[model samples]
Target: MTVLEIEYKTLLNQDEFNRLESRLAHVKPITQTNYYFDTSDFVLKAHRMSLRIRTFSDKAELTLKIPQEVGNVEHNQTLLLPEAKEAIKTAILPNGEIKTLLVQKGIPLEELLVLGHLTTIRRESQTSIGLLALDYNQYAGLKDYELELEVLDAEKGKIDFDNFLEQHNIDFKYAKSKVARFTSTLKKNDQ
Candidate 1:
């Protein structure tokens, strides 16, 4: 399946996450682990793309995200346990639309390699403007929180998000994708 993901992402500290979670106690949270992949030289990152195998409780999915004008265009395919293991072990892009898209973009399948992993505890609630998500993520012995408003309508979503922030008195700032942030950390540690 393909989707156009239109969302605004902002960084949050532990205190903010705690307060937000308390206020959103009615929403149940789900935990998922994302194993990300890229070439040793970071070909996917250079292309502003990402590939990952996301494992939930009973299912796993391989997803590819490519930069788009409005938002990131995502292509996802379901994967069985064996396929997910083999793909991670060999750093091979999964066979399907995601693989085809990568190949079309001139990213050699063989060069793709496992980058790192991150786990997120996510809670979501539906709002008039869009879906609101509070994500607490951990990777590489580091932890952080993020707020995302996945908007169906960009203009309205923006207006709603701004008002939401103002109403909550949140002065948080936006950041790049989780993959990008983890990749940067990996690079810094390597040096």
Candidate 2:
């Protein structure tokens, strides 16, 4: 399945996340781990794309995200644990639409490799404007909080997200994706 993901994201500190969590006492949270992949030379990142296998308690999915004019277009495919393991073992892209899409875009599927993993505890709420999520993510011993709003209308979603921040008096700046942050930290540690 393919979807146009329209979302705005921002970073939050621990105190801000705690405050927001208290306000969202009614929402249930889910925990998941995301294992990110890219070529040795970071071909996917060079193309402004990302690939990951997300594992929840009961299911797993392989996803590819390609940048679009308005938002990222995500392609997702369900995977069995064995299949995911096979792909990881071979350092190959998962076999399905995601692989076909990458081949179509001139990315060599055989070169894909695991970058790292991030685990997140997330709670979501549906609003008139879109889906709002509060996320606490950890990777490579680093942890952070984030707010994400995914909507059908980008302009309206931005307005809603901005208003929410102001209403809470939370001082947040724009945040990069988990994969990006993890890779940056890895690079810094290597140096």
Candidate 3:
């Protein structure tokens, strides 16, 4: 399936993360692992595209995200456990919607390879304006926290997100996507 996602995200200081979580009702953490993929030459990065297979406890799904005017166009396809494993080990996508989309975009499947993975512990809840997610992410020997608000309307969501930060006395931070951050760290460590 394909989706257009509109959301606002910001990096959070530890204090901000804790204060925000304290006000929300108690909830169990949802843990997920994302195995990111890219070409050695960074073809996908050049186009601001990202591909990954995200795994929860029992399911895995491959997704390719392309930048769009409002947000991103996400193309997703479900994968069975065996298929997910094989793709990770081989860096070859299984036959699915994600692969079809990549083929149409001229991404060379043979060159797609696993870069690495990130594990996230997330607490999420539905708010009046959107879905609120606070995430603690671990990758490449680094860890950080983030707050994200996903909404249907981009303009309204940005306003709400900004107001939320102001009410909490939190300053905005330039938040890069998980894939971009992870890849950057990976590139750094390789040097």
Candidate 4:
């Protein structure tokens, strides 16, 4: 898939934020939460991306996965194929414009809830994003919260990311896997 997005690197402080708020005029800021889930052995995922176009901001994300799992194999490994649940994304353009897309699935919500076993729940917002994916019974057994920022660029995203972290004195470990792995850690911890 073609990944297309823009990004910005700027820190927001209280005093500067007041000016930003004043500049916003009548536009109201938004924040909300979303609960997501997948299945056993890499069946689910959540993907998000952000962009900046001149004076606007755009973001997109997708979740809901089902992986084919192989069980009872000892001392070896399993090859898994995971199906991405269509794709749902949201974005904002250079003029402070916003857009969103939702996946089409006719399955009854009640049935999906029953079949998927509710392995993940995520609460994402403008300032941050949160995720928890695990076996239903173990969902309440663990609590993990983390902060992250993704700067999209053909080149410079890594450099810019490092600079932002260094300037803020934010200590971070290189992400060893995809961000989706963080969302899947909840389920992995169940074992």
Index of the highest-lDDT prediction? 3
Cα shift from native, residue 151, model 2 (Å): 1.0
Candidate 2, clashing residue pairs?
Answer: none
Evaluated against the true structure, the overall lDDT of model 4 is 0.29
Candidate 2's displacement at residue 83, Å, is 2.5
Model 1, 1-191: lDDT tens digits are 99999998789877778889999999989998899998888888889888899988877899999888898888889998778878888887666888888889999788877888999999999888789999999999998899999987878888888888888878858778998888888988999
Q: CA lDDT of 9 in candidate 2? A: 88
The sequence of per-residue lDDT tens digits that candidate 2 reaches over residues 1-191 is: 99999999899988889999998989989998888889889999999999998888877889999889999999999988777776666767656898888889999777788888899999999977688899999999999999998999888888888898899998868799878988898788889
Output candidate 3 Cα RMSD: 1.2
Better candidate by lDDT, 2 or 3:
3
Candidate 1 Cα misplacement greater than 4 A, ranges: none
What lDDT tens digits, residue by residue, belong to model 4 across residues 35-101? 2332233222222221111111233232222222311111111111111122111121111111111
Please list all clashing residue pairs in model 1, or write none if there are none. none
**Candidate 3: segments with Cα more than 4 A from true spot:** none
Worst 10 residues of 1 by lDDT: 86-95
- Residue 118 in model 1: shift from native, Å? 0.7
- What tens-digit string does per-residue lDDT give for candidate 3 at 1-191? 99998899999999998898787649778999999998999888987899999988888999999999889999999988788888999998989788888889899989988999999999999999899999999999999999999999988999999999999888899799999889989878889
Weakest ten-residue segment in model 2 by summed lDDT: 86-95
Show pairs that collide, candidate 3.
Answer: none
